[model samples]
Target: MGGNELPLQRIEPVSVSGRGLPRWLRRTSGPVALVLLWHILSVTGVLPSEVLAGPSTVLSSAATLIETGELQEAMWVSLSRALTGLAIGGSIGVTLAVIAGLFRLGEDLVDATMQMMRTVPNVALIPLLIIWFGIGEAPKIALIALGTAFPLYLNVYAGIRNVDQSLIEVGRTLGLSRLAMIVNVVLPGALPSALVGLRYSLGIAWLALVFGEQINATAGIGYLMANAREFFQTDVIVVCLVVYALLGLGVDFTVRTLEKVFLSWRPAFNGT
Candidate 1:
């Protein structure tokens, strides 16, 4: 053997097929399987159309609605309402959480009131909302805001408070001003938790939208579904439900992608 040469070892390429597919397809497998099973059951007459509409029937209904622009209009309304409410709620939540997390006096004044309101179910306030806001868009938007705020508040507060003392000390030692320390060290350190809160708040916003639109909306998916229910249009109802599920999944995927991008600086496996 040459003094500089080491023995060669053969290495086999690992098969990813055993894990089923690439990341995207793997993530979709469960929903695809469930859809296939649903189709099978529907075709086999195991599931009655009256009780539940199959994916095919719902797809057809959705296509019809889309062609007529009904679904598009309804979806736009719901999306606008949801986004508006989320913006309002998220801003309030982050502001309050930052205040309370950073200062003892702020916590004493604001945190307890928030905690009390958080314990009260947002849905339960619907009757009062209807009475106060008079079954208009205001009540619906308010409900969504209410639903979205609590989770963000809880998560953001926790995140800010949980920021490493060592980092804060280092920032101070480096002669960072209070605002500078918050912007650089505190906010960056608290970001993961804040993102988590954002994801959770988004979910709550969707749920709130669903409930809100069901109340007295002239348009929106919930209104369409409610109208369909009265006439026994199972496929349309299913379409509405499918839309909600897809929206939720899309939002979750967006947030997950954001997390991966923003948290790239952290080490993998609990940052160990």
Candidate 2:
């Protein structure tokens, strides 16, 4: 047989792997390409001048702010506020979720009130927060906490309540105490859901920063955006927004990595 004429039966299929790149990045490439195209159009004057800012302009503004330490200071303030609020809101939300999930009356008592609060926008409460806490870090943190609490509460509550009855029965049959069952069975079952809630609450805390900056005297990405808005500095605004997006992505990625590392028992984190 000629060397070039290899039989199909003799050859094993060589699989080409999409390794060295995350599946998410691969999936998002299409949208990123479109964004690049839009950016190019904006730079070339194809898009409306007022509505869209060129990437270069935004990058230049960001570089200037970074060089001047404005970006760093703003990032510190915003991240501090976000983390503090997340701690407070997440703690309370998880506490309430545990209480409500354990006791039926707790859910009944809190549900309607939480529903009412959920309907109320964090921005709307700014005036009242100012009156109560003054124009300080307290009010800003409180606002973020308020915005963050509901999502965590909802998700954690569902997680707790949705724990498999069969698992509970199995624990009971095994002669496990109530607390033991909760720790071993209920909490584990609910952990994945609670993680989802945690990630979501973190996002909401960031979102509430918009309302926080409007009232607060100074500092934070939100403040930067507000200041940029006043001067019609669209590039600065865009830069701050881009930073916010990156920070959110960073936080989410950290959370996801933690979940994968710690909760490997769950199929959701099987690396498949």
Residue-wise lDDT of candidate 1 within 143-218, one digit each (tens)? 9999888889999899999999999999999999999999999988889998999999889988999899988899
Residue pair clashes in candidate 2: none
Task: Kindly provide the TM-score of model 2 when superposed on the true structure, using C-alpha atoms.
Answer: 0.87
Candidate 2 lDDT, tens digit per residue, 134-178?
A: 998999999989988888888888998999899999999999998
Model 2: CA > 4 A from native: 1-25, 48-50, 269-272
**Deviation in angstroms for 250 in model 1?**
1.6
Ten contiguous residues with the weakest lDDT in model 1: 12-21
